[model samples]
Target: MSKVLTVDPSLCTGCHRCEMWCSLTKYGEINPSRSNIYVLRREPAVDVPVICVQCGLCINACPTGALKRDGATDAVVVDADVCSGCGTCVKICPYGVLRLDEDTGVAAKCDLCGGSPACASHCPQGAIKYEDINKAAARRRELWAMACAVRIRG
Candidate 1:
């Protein structure tokens, strides 16, 4: 089964270890701006890790056909050679996870690190998990059901 990155905001502690590892693995540095996974912190002390869900929506939006899903990993990847850095993918992404690399002048986002994501593997809080897509969907449904039950009871 293909895998996906599942995020649990409740587990996140804003440690930024995911970002550090991601950038280090990808760029040989600890630059958060270059990391594909981003941690957004809310005013109420909430940290939400945002990343490419590999939904493939951006692939359809790429005019240059730079974005394509890797057959092995099901990861939406950017082909630097084909990418025009037009920023269309960035705008098309509903979650706003895509970006153009400042140095490369090319589109960049999570490629699941060739199927074993650095962000998910290094996340200290277990906020990000690399798991089967079906499992992730089932988990999401369970969470939704629990939330609905609480709402109905209250």
Candidate 2:
């Protein structure tokens, strides 16, 4: 699963449809408890949706060795049998989306929508886009180059 979900904080209206989509996929409910995407406020000014950093903080936080990589891909898998649901992984997640399911008491979050994120599909504002890290980086670089060229001409 690709980890990067590029977000435009400026365009975020904080409607939280992404969270709803995430929860529905994970828990079959509208509850944010199952969502792996976090919506943070930049105050009355903005709301930023934060998802997995893919930095491996939650992966590293797994003390029971429940969290493991797919080896064949970027997907992260959790072994519920080994998971004690101590909330360590949940607490360690910087995005705050990772949460201990109140019902199951197990940690859960966005698993990349099983590689086809509903958030990106359902985003009304076009604020979220799922793409490869390398391609996204290249796009950003191109934007920066455009900015530099415009500056020189102006």
Candidate 3:
């Protein structure tokens, strides 16, 4: 069962705690730009946390075979040595989660912190969850079913 990071945008408070924790854990700093999990602020109070969902589109887009999935964590691992910093992976990423590190010139994305994601653990609003994709999909379907029932009754 592959687990993925899921975000509930409605519950996000835009505190950037996820970003801070991600940067601190990965880079030992508090730079949001370096954080793999980013907050997209569309309005003053509306924020969406953008993260890599392990969709594999970036892996296919990598021309140098630098991106591959880690079987243990199901997270995409970027091989800096093999990567040419071509930016194709970054450009093809649908969620814009991949970024080329300015200093390293290597593409960076969420690696799920080697299976225990810091962002999901530190999310203040319970907006982010790391769960099995099948279980998550089932829960989503249940929610939609309840919503439809309410609409029909009302």
> Whose TM-score is greatest here?
1
**Local accuracy of candidate 1 as per-residue lDDT tens digits, 22-129:** 999999999999999999999799899998888899998999999998999988989999999999999999999999999999999999999889999988878899
Write out the backbone clash pairs for model 3.
none
Model 2 earns a TM-score of: 0.79
* TM-scores, all models, native as reference: 0.92, 0.79, 0.87
Per-candidate clashes come to: 0, 0, 0
* C-alpha positional error of residue 26 in candidate 1 after TM-score superposition, expressed in Å: 1.0
Candidate numbers, best TM-score first, in rank order = 1, 3, 2
In terms of lDDT, model 2 sits at: 0.74
Q: What is the C-alpha lDDT of each candidate?
A: 0.92, 0.74, 0.90
**Which RMSD values do the candidates have, in order?**
1.7, 4.3, 3.1
Residue 132 displacement in candidate 3 (angstroms): 2.0
lDDT of 2 by residue, 1-154 (tens): 3446677665788989998988887778887656778777876668988876556677887989887765543556667788899988878877676677778877776667666788877788977878888876776577578778989999
Top candidate on lDDT is 1
